[model samples]
Target: MKKTRYYPFERNRYFYGKLLTVRDFESEQKYFNDKRRMMNRLLHGYGVLTGLQVIAVDDKSVSVEMGAAIDALGREIVVPSPMTLKLSMMDGFTNNEYAKNVYLCIAYDEKDKEPVHTVANSSVRSDEINDYNRVLESYRLFIREDAPDPASLPLAGITDQTVVIYQDAHVRVLQTTPRYVNPGQLFEMKLRFEKTLKAGRLSFSYEMASERIEAIHGATIMFQEPQEQLESEYEIKVLLRADSTVNVKGTVGVKEESAILKLDDCQLDLQEQAFGEIQIIKEPVRERLMSDFVKQSLEASLESPSEPCIYLAKICLIQMGPTYVIERVEQVPFGEYVFNSSVMYRLAHSAEYRDETAGQFVTKSKVKTLAPGRPPEFKVNYNPAMSELAFDVGIPVGGGGGIGGIVSGVVDIPIEPFTKINVSPFGKPSKSFFSGEIAHGLGEGNVLILTSLEETSVDSISDMLANGERVYGGSSDVFKGSEFEPEAPEVKIGTIAYPQKGTFRIGVKLQQPSEPFDVRVRWWAYSAETASSGSSSGGGDRLDEALSALREAASAGSDAE
Candidate 1:
């Protein structure tokens, strides 16, 4: 069958902290008859994590800070100033801080999950590339004045392998350069000197005092001494391995919540505005969807004879925030959120036209008897205020295809079979809450989960920028196999929870969350033999017409009324 998809961009409402807001939707009065504007019914709540760093100087001062922004969809969210840096010095400094010998310092967060670039054999270390690497910061003397002219001092020349010293009438020269170095090596050094004097010339004597040199920057340092302060140019390089690995995993679970989901009102209507249509892959047939695709595609949909009731299935949901389980109640700290809902539908052909079609072409569903059966009933499990939940209701077995036959129960059909809320012989039905009573919806499948996350970082007195990827799960599909062209997911924007640090975002491995939720869904099973008309709108339509049908089906029992 030719596939057709309708996604109405209107009549959609957004969830704001468990409360539904109309700001995301247009009113029905202004809506038009847009058939292409079908509703997106699969629930979505995925979390994308990125990071940033802000610099706060001397604990209180707004020094310079920097942050890197990444997104889960593999996009670089430009952070104008992820870090705020200040060029001024500390308060107590009065030239002494600069005039005196100075030492370089290093500091950085030791978070374990950051994506690191590993260096092999002759590759340069992280300190050699990224300037922010804390390994270059230290208390080692960075500035010295042992040279005849203070301006002649070597600062950046032999950064990791040199130091200077001076005495009253003389200066000492200690060279700690190694002839050869390898990947896995360390070095150190130490030297001393005493001064000797000569008159008239204002001269001084120099000697190689101490001769102990250690490893420096992964290589052993062998300093050569000279009679006078030796002036030499040298370079010390380091090679570090950054290829790191750790375990990563995510799961969904059930827990208790202190508060109940309070759904003030949730309305879904076909808005007159039609944004456009979408095309997706599907199973070869309905029976194949359950036999093969069901276990694989956690969220999918299929067409049926029903015009409005699309058989949306397996919409997996992942909770979007921190969740706690106390006393079996799940307490999720849900913030500004977005969710997805999806369903499948198909247009039916008239009997007059079907009779003229070639039997070699398309087939139809096996019509079953509907002599008066029971309806479904259920109970509410979780709070309605949740950003999303699962809703599935099917028919029960026995009683000669009673009222429950139309629901989640198995029915015999041929050729390209049709999917239904009816439970198969051995298949399990997804549950939900619907009608005045608590029960499952008319569909069976996974509930899609979607949400936004803010990066969390540890505060430091001297360290500035502290932005990182937001850690959250979402249900959107990311096509990673397409080599010709790439696709992007919904790019959501959010404010950082903390102030000091600059904003940053990055893509994450975003996995699905395992949280269980129950919502109500009202389903109806109509006879395929029945004609489609306003009078027989199916479930509620036959209501007023079937009082005796209701008598024998009072309490809306599955088979016993």
Candidate 2:
């Protein structure tokens, strides 16, 4: 005889919001701006309060109250706590200092059939330290469109429209039970879209984007490479299961080389469900930032007297895990700026306050001039918001002076990239910087990688760890078919700002154990030290070679067996 039970799920995941109460300031102890707690707060910390809530729960459906007019329009919309009852909010990153302020997030997977908010994080961040405060103010925090703090836009045609947008996109399901979902688990699920989507215009794509569900909460939405990208028109697809809910608006547009659909307003539902058995799956989470996650120093030209500014960006593979936070991205301490104009001005400086933090730091510099101009070379600089990586725009500062942009504390990248290497407990990550050959390319022998490693030269190892990088060395274990016994993976981990000298070697190498296994290496710059005056000519055409190498390696080992 066999026994069977029914478990129901839904198609939507939510992004929560936080609330601020009168008691918050007292509890905060002024750590919101403190640099000391930034690291812990960024990774393990919570915002001023709990995460923002987007929906309310009922017996049959999840009732959502969209943020009202003038506020919460284009940004990641979040509203004040809708309930008046005395509530003891969930306490994942919560420190009592932020008393009374309610936090929201996908509070609980409103759709999980489990009994607990297992789909969400319950540990709160409570610190009034430096690094901690900086992290809080970085990535997810934005003032309401109507708020007085500035940067918010007016919602004439956009405000009320977003409410409709939320309505058309969100759904209702039971609160996700506090259960662990492993890969390959299946369950019955349901949903109710607010608007009736057209057939052809509506399409769906299912993906197992976020591979690390055991550690964080939420899911990385996946969508199809749309047919159009610049138009206002959009398509929606309802995934029956094991797929994605893609929103297609506009035609295929070229963005960063690849064909991708673009839209000012887009919402995709890449519902990642836990396969296998829930009871057996432990949430896979890496609580600390990897060596690659650090602020690199930069030297850019400044046109005016303003607070030091830096540009940073990191490419994260969206599916690494559920929840992600930028723990730290401190600017370099020194740099140099060279302007060609007759009125040459140079500015070189370090952190307003250094010698006070823990993470490895870099120096920064900037130069501006109006003399006969020439294109500038590359340089590294830190970006507060994108803590783990950095970005260097090609069109260097020119035309001399009308005031370039300057961010106050941390700044968010304009768009979240598809892939980014987050911190992990497994080993050092981002063990290499994609450069030297045609700027950056993913190739077989051309690309540097660390399959797994146990050791490196003393200087090499220290250089990486201090910078939060992942490098792989080699060992005799490659033949043993065991762990990486060569002491280091074959890959060499490094920062975009600094590249190694001499004929640098990569870390350990290994063969893929499964079919269609893939990986990526991107071009990154964190400081002036790592910047290059030259550009990469043809790099995108090499991905196949990289994959083939890993595949062949695997085949050789399998044949030996």
Off by over 4 Å in 1: 1-106, 109-174, 179-561
**Candidate 2 segments exceeding 4 Å error:** 1-377, 386-455, 459-485, 489-509, 512-561
TM per candidate comes to 0.13, 0.15
Whole-model alpha-carbon lDDT for candidate 1: 0.24
Error of 1 at 23 (Å): 42
The digit string of per-residue lDDT tens for model 2 on 1-561 reads 111111121222224665655355534543432323332223222211222223324211122232311111111123344532111222233322221112222211112222333222333433322221122211221111111111111111111111111212111111111122223333322211211111112332232222222212222222332455321123332221221222211111012212121222343432323222112232331211121133311111101112111111110111113322222111111111112223222221224233334355444543321111236555567765433334343433222211111000101111111234434486533322232322211111222222222233346655766732432222234435543233232232232211332122221122212222122222111111111112134522333353454455435433211
Report the lDDT tens digits of candidate 1 across residue range 144-205: 12222211221112122233332221223222322222222332232332222110111212
**Models, CA RMSD each:** 41.7, 32.0
